[model samples]
Target: MSKLRLVHCLLFFTAICILLPPIAARGGHSDYIHPGDGNSSFHGIARHLFAQEEPRPSLELTRGYMTNDDLEKAMKDFTKRCSKISRLYSIGKSVNGFPLWVIEISDRPGEIEAEPAFKYIGNVHGDEPVGRELLLRLANWICDNYKKDPLAQMIVENVHLHILPSLNPDGFSVRKRNNANNVDLNRDFPDQFFPMNEDLALRQPETRAIMTWLRNTRFTASATLHGGALVANFPWDGTEDRRKYYYGCPDDETFRFLARIYSKSHRNMSLSQEFKEGITNGASWYPIYGGMQDWNYIHGGCFELTLEISDNKWPRAAELPTIWDYNRKSMLNLVASLVKTGVHGRIFSLDQGKPLPGLVVVQGINYTVKAHQAYVDYHRLLAPGQKYEVTASSPGYKPRTTSIYLGDNAVTADFILIPEASSRGKLLRSNCDCSCKNCGQPLLAQFFPETNNGITLTLVVVVVFLCFLLQRRVRYNLWKQKQSSRRSITV
Candidate 1:
């Protein structure tokens, strides 16, 4: 081939290679894999040239692992065992028709109230089963320690916690990352920057189930579990350029604070030598399109984190208890952070004293928290020990903003908006009480009670209009006089 032709061919091949998914997330997650043969992929050969930084310990996948049927049975038993504070329900079914079970833990299990609700989604990737296992253990632990443990009692009575242990049970059964149809659930949501996942029909059943769940329920904040790296990941998960860089969402500080809480609470997550605080912005680490983390924050109004709890995605079943113990504090602190911090309140209309479904936003933060449709209530999560200017807005009504020092306690930041059209109506209502008999009485009668019938309102209005016209005519005459004087030719 000629040199020019060879150059063109080489450039095309390079573009294709760059676009292909990684064999596995380098030392992180392996979300993408070779479809035909998993062994077609391999870790970087450089590990052979240089000693591997971290040795891979022997992992026995089936030793203590629960099968799909066993997990379902465990969930069913938990509901029966702790029927008062927990209820077992299915959000939707997976592609294989396996019911996507959820265990809701609250004092009033399914009743809707003013309290905030949180959700924990696990096993997004079929291969990462640790999250699913840990979640079931969390539910059982809470049940075992309900009022006996302070934190457990607080979560049960104050917050509505929903736990979906396995979203991709079919994938878990097959021991792969993708679901039965081979669509990666993490990359299957509707993206704001791209249209690849926008077509609803193209979405997987698991993705549709999550989308429908968010629509029916309002979650204050949530977290999804994954494995590969040990760090707390926050949004915006993807960047506009699709390049690797630190791209923070509007609520960067708040997300960082939240991530720090989880890491610090964990046994040794905060001691990580790779990540600074054992927390990273998703885009900073790597950019993935159609990620659930960004979609939850954008569409569902839920502050979500992608947590990589273990270096090995599938650790030995014997290590499961140790892993759960390491993550227990982080999980509890994250859920407790919902009720322990931030500002929450309902928006109201000034005229009718009714609720207004307005938006709550922090001044410097670009994110918006939406009020619930039923009660017009909003829950905004922010880091404590800071002064923030919070604003609330709605259509056709004036937006209201206020500054408050949000301490450790949850501050009630309610707003009352005045509709734009109400000004004229209020003025008219003030002028006359809409009484026919009072039509002839001047509005000034309120100032002078004895002149109640002295000057008819109609006569007063005519006199005022006549004075306005006369004043305008006098001004015109003065202008004509000045113009004529200035235009007159010198004699």
Candidate 2:
């Protein structure tokens, strides 16, 4: 053969050598001997490298636990049984289309009140079914004893308590740690430091439902139940640098106080040997990204804690009763803490005595607690035995600050904001009657004579039209002056 032909053949052989191994590997197992055939070391190494997750636990393991349908029935039954104080609602559906049911327990359920709100979420992880069971118990216990038990009665009357029994019903059915889409719901929320999970379209249904639910309801404090650990975990869940260290949010001390309420009230959570005082800061223990605990605090203005109630991820169904017994007081106390320890108040306008829907902020803390729009009520949770300078402010009004020595009980600190001088003049103009101030006649009635009934009606229409033009002219002048001022500043 010629030299060029020989060279071409050599290049083709080299290309075949480079690609043949992978092609043959994909073609058939006959090309390669199985590591499991004889060599124990190769078999072990291969198995370890490509190991799959453990099989989903059989339904037999969840025999005594309530299924998704059973939970829905139980929630509906509880609402029917205690219709006077409870309401059953669905926030949204899961990946598998299971309704995310929530039971609201309050004296005036479904009605917005000045009272603070609290929420408890169970079964964030599908395999950690303990919280879901315990939450049902919590609801029934309140329904059965609210008439006699003061704690239960207090929760029913003073606070709007929302309990979500299962956030990951799809995962719970399959006994997996993630939702039906295999996305970990806890880690699917938008992160603070990272832009990951910012696209709402890409978010999991479970996380989106939670984000939407929080937008509708204003919760002062909340907790989610999980297993495989026993402690109260609080934000900041993840650090900015992604390092494992103690990172706390703006209300770190207040969060610690809230977490301790659950830890100390528990039968033996505070006695844990692993976690100090059975309360661990999330980042201190281990930093995790996109956790719901931090997102609630940062975005929704809700203080949320991740409560690991059981050491075993999936304890026997027979042990659930004991687990509930251990956590019942803790859960109740945590809910009661919203009413017992916070600095609660309403913000009003001094001129009109109307609700201002203002903001309540403490002097030293960086966080701002917003008052409700309807009631203008604000619930600020703080550590007891501390003096705080609480300030309430609103647009077009002067802010008012008050200092209070909060004791063991909640303190009411209502604020009445005074309008600014310019704002007061505008308010006066807006509320002024469309009549002559000096003479007791309509402002523009003088322009027309009082002749017949037809002329009188015509005069009224003309006066109203003139007043509308005057108001529009006044607003346009203000806008013009504002634009002029901006131009001067830019120049």
Candidate 3:
């Protein structure tokens, strides 16, 4: 081999190494979406051919927006910086294999506690990237101010806040409204009145991830962010006849209350002329079937709201700061609402004072909230300044009802249920009252008016029996805990 030829070969290999890295990086980070990958249906082609094309701004509008990879890094960085109060995890992956990262913020991050859990999911529609940006801001704001700010501190100490910045990273990468498969995720959940999205096999991976997440984590309430409008929308997102009118769920008043919390806190959302008080019922605004908001309520036992934060979709990147400012308070207050104004408590059986994973029902609201299996704690969100008859019951136990006048602050009303065996009610009546007036107190101080000896004997026997039952119950629960592997749903 000639010396000159050897030098030329060395130069060629060096050039290949230098150029390949940049080419690979560009391919990995590019936001470009192939038209073929986006749509292949005849309907899609026909619509494109006949429909007039609307003017779309160049990618310049997304100049300051974080790419999918950048967003993933931001979440990781946040968790590291705020490791004391935050944990980073993923619900699932997008069609393009982008991790759906979630940032969980709490005083005790990743550890189960008797606290209400709330989630904020943004960027359901890829084009509506404002939510994703604002959600990141929300997490950062909470991290920065949790130590000094009362609202942030309360949320961190009392509630488990999960923030998923972008649910549709694939669509966002392409600046489209749908996912990579060209399906609208907001309309991809199971519907109450329709069976179109009832097939699990046909469900998108993004939708399935959300469904599985909810099943695993007991979210008390949640809200998704969007763009193209400015109003807080709450469920019955659809109707049986597909008509557009005021269609409400059984918890209409509660939903309205929850929606108002966001709209009223926004800088100018409440001043909107279109939606009254900057809030609208989903069906009343315009019926949409298989909406995530409705499915969250119906299937997941979570009250969810669809919030349209901006009038312009894909606004200039420079406007993100101002938009975040407008929504900062609304976001903080909505999370704080979980701990500030609600009915939260645990249920226990009188026999052994064991936590009973029972059902909590509020009178006049045709919905039942179940207590956490581990802690038996339930968080029921209700509008403040109202009287509610809360009833807690479990199988084989006598239900107890208590009236609470929920004021501006939250109320904790625990229940001690009695077994429904014959003569058990009469025997336990003196010690089985709920957290109402004179709870669990002896109605008869003296079993016999004349004999103090009889009352003393009765008390001694009851205490002995209760002590035995309590010991047995504790041992049984410990054995079950050792044998069974149960998923922990943070209260």
Candidate 4:
């Protein structure tokens, strides 16, 4: 080869290396959809999309949007910084090699082994990304401000928060709606529908990881986050048939209470209202089979909820400030409510009044009307010989609730919570003032003296602006270097 030709090739290769650094840094040809208009500012596009017409009180707590990479870093940073408060672990790995990370935040380390723990997961779907951001914010907020904030202190001190910030990491990496295998992890559970050609049961690693965690952890109350809807979807989601829509199948009253807590948290976004106006009610809405919520309820015997965060397909980054405003308080309320109640029971029936094994009973006592769901594991703690105000329900029988004292930590409480002969009970209007319409009453109002320690929303705005400045500076430096290299090559 001629020396001139060699020189030309070397120069071309150098130019390529200099100009393509951004592409290289972005993880190699991944289709990460940034929220932007005209391909300029993804953040601006996100902001405009989630922009609320009427300002809400709670929408001001978000500081900024974290990219997938940033989120990973934040998780690492949090665990490292607050090692005293949290323990980070990889539940599994995504198809893209990102760890499915879970940060177990607690005041007491041994509590998880001793007592039943509650779990909260965010960003199961890649599109609904706010929960991932929010959970991080919540974790950070609690760690930073717990000493000053009573609510934060109470939560960390009491309940052990097992948070999975990003469940569908493969989906998150590519910004796809489903996992890398094109399977919706939510619908990939081992249920009655399993072995059917359509079901992706135990197929995806993500599903397997979550299922394994549930089997191992013994979670009391759990929730998964999604978007493109504005309601908290509870169990029996597979069916819309009213005939099969009674509160509880095996445990009527307990299901009702669970449903009530979910409803309360979201200010009572009614199933009827959701069906009338929400996305899932539409004929065009994607129908999922063998989802996580149903499997959790039936197989795991865990009370779980699917919290649909936003109505937008991809909520705008710019609107995150506003979105967090509405969500932060509601999230806090939901977590706080879970630890408030003491005695929770679910009434059920047995064949010839015999004790049925593996029955779930939830008893809610000192019920205060609140708009958030409280966390309780009525199933695992129930013993053979303990006294419980039980509401027993089983499939193909009349639902029943009764008071019984058991013997020697035994399993199974059999009582018939009378099922309505017809599904004609007057729909009671929720008297709750809390966010969720179905929550009975605010437990905080009863116990902790209410204080006007409003969240420092202003701090969030300042932090967000600082993040914006930092990002802009980084982009500017990259752009400047690219321009300089282009000029040099031209000369």
Candidate 5:
């Protein structure tokens, strides 16, 4: 509270900010335990633990294409036309104030279903506009074909597919790789290995919007569309040591399988000579920091892939239809893949027979997926033909594990957790808090003795730091006063 202390505190904060940039440049952002390490029942996300843009292909010839404004209108139109099957919503606005619109396609639009949810994000790189065009085509195609096409029907009935055609419309409008502020939207997420972009203010509006959207929604599986390459990229986006190498996450096998599904479904992606199988580990392709793909996997409990759908960043607008055709099956298959593979189930309370929105973990996999709060439904994707030990756990409830051989078709595993009433008593008597709560003391006081200790220690640290700041300020002021006195005497 002293003037001297305040000055010192101000200096300390300024120093912290000044020292952060270079380190952020090296790592850039924000546990991934996908695999490679040993042992199961949830491996560590990361072993070390610590962790294009196309040019003026031109807006002049953009007649047949949907402008950002057109895209918004088209989205609204689709929701209206497919009123029974679809609805429109916005995540947030872009830096240039473009509403980031999303069209949700499902049997029951805007309603919560125990069904698995999948999202397709496109046009992350503004100049690689192929994704945005293709995604709109995809949304329309499903709407028109869902009646007759079994694949389309399957997707509409089984999955809630949310399509965000353009994440960086400002970047797209300018025909650049980044958003309006020139920040690469794809590279603005918090990376796990290097904690760069961890500060919310430093991240761009588009990035913040995506983060906020993830916090509100639970996506079982999702994919973002990118152009300029013809391969599917999976995590770990960067290695632990920041080296360029083939690094894999805990569910490396599962991710590879997912990638393969897209590549093979595409007309010619599977024939790529650059990346065998048309799939490359993200780091193997290129090392990047603060990528959206890795962050989705790490924090959102969402299985995400970075799909490079086109080799040409900006092919002629005429190629849009062909590109959509090429990617149509892949897109539909990828969404349907959610219902066709992995483990699908719900959790419930044994006593009340009520749903519990608990978390599901595969024994060997490092990631955890949470069930929908309303439906208590969860969908987990793993490589088919693998045997996995799946475990479901909820707070204050007994955890349960089950083993199953997951085949090509989806397998259902429901859990009923028993409530554990004596956990609090066990916690107080545990080694972490050895002494029993004194009967003579207030119940609240005895129960939270460790919390009280923590507060006391925190106060002590704050006081000491304040004193140090005050001393430094006092010394600095004295030095200034001495210099003034010396000048006056000399005069």
Candidate 6:
């Protein structure tokens, strides 16, 4: 063959190799094998390489031990064994068409509200796969040991555990960080009115399914499992001037109560510490525009927690056992804590006489109030029924408290905030500053006629007309070029 032709052929082969899947394109590496291949040496080596670095020895051993198939099969096997205790269903499909399975484990079956439901979602991001495996293991362990383990029996009997083992299956399949459309599922929520990129907002099927499921189910408390920095991020991300993030809502007492429960259970975890010197503002963590936890709190009315499970990226299979050891108790503790405090309520608008769309209704204390009884602080921005609050409030409104009692099951409360006439009048008066002695002009002089509406309409018309004219010009140029080419061809 000619040297030039040979070079071209070689380049073509290289391009083909680059385009192929990694498992197929790479010629040399260990062959993909099943976890149960019975080769102890291989399993040991794999475990060692992916071992977790946490001080908890038990969890580090089992951290990176299972694959996607292992988890799926385990879920199926678990359902078969515990048919009486749990039922599995497809909540939604992932972007890659994988089923987003939700395994409902309960003591009795009927409307979920008949019993308390605790939601545990794992692997929202594909890179953090351990939660999926751990959840399966937990399910299996609970079923298998329920007869013997009193704690397991107590949990199964009292709480209905809803386990979403994989939230972003498309991301999990390729081991990518984000979903198939490269959107972070955690940040793709509709909590605010701002427009989202059409491609991204509706891009990931997994996220869509999750949102639908959450809308239908009324959960008391929920946790989303992720892997990266290990910390339990709480509500009301720090303020601009504050050194550390404070739970800003009136229900800060409740926020602290929940945080304290989580911290007490996972005392060894970094999130156990109180607001201190090194902590970052809760809201400013990564500056995410819309997040699942925030939406859950503001819109879903659930006390949601973002649980960062591990520090290792793609932890080794062997590390699975270790991860479970440390987290299993913590996860169980959250469920127990929710059962202990059945706190629940809805937020409403003070002026509109309807549910507020987006607000922070927290169960905390107002700094100005005497520190005696626990009272939830209300931020003016909370969405109705999206957060757990014993009390609710809005701007220019009197705060309302509910007598709803929290327990092992669900509780509901509606807030009716009374608008403050004085506050409303002050807001309506636009030129109250005109009363300043230095300003000689009357308040009415500072006010302009309502010409803004006409100007806005005119601007819209002009822009539309310009766009139409540009489209016509471009089409005419294309037509003229085509006509000229046809004449030349005839010549």
lDDT of 1 by residue, 279-398 (tens): 988877777766799999999989999899998888888899999999998999899888677887667654334567888888888788889888787788998889998899988678
Predicted structure with the largest TM-score when compared to the true one: 3
State the local distance difference test value for candidate 5.
0.75
- Predicted candidate 3, C-alpha RMSD: 13.9
Give one digit per residue, the lDDT tens place, for model 6 in 165-190.
88877766666656776666664564
Give residue 429's lDDT in candidate 3 (0 to 100): 38
For every model shown, the clashing-pair count is: 0, 0, 1, 59, 19, 48
Residue-by-residue lDDT tens digits, candidate 4, 333-430? 55654444333322322112112222334465322111111221233323232456645444444544456554332232223222233354222221
**Pairs of residues at least 3 apart in sequence or in different chains that clash in candidate 1:** none
Cα RMSD of predicted structure 4: 25.1
Against the true structure, candidate 2 reaches a TM-score of 0.77
TM-score list, all predictions: 0.77, 0.77, 0.79, 0.55, 0.75, 0.56
Clashing pairs in 3: 115-491
lDDT of 5 by residue, 168-216 (tens): 8997887776677666676678778766556676678888888898888
Off by over 4 Å in 1: 1-60, 419-491
| Candidate 2 lDDT by residue in tens digits, 334-403 | 9999877768767765444456889989998999999998888788999988998889999988999888
- Sorting all predicted structures by TM-score, with the top scorer first, yields 3, 1, 2, 5, 6, 4
Q: Determine which window of 10 residues in candidate 2 has minimal summed lDDT.
A: 23-32
Local distance difference test scores for all models: 0.76, 0.78, 0.78, 0.51, 0.75, 0.53
lDDT-best of 3 and 6: 3
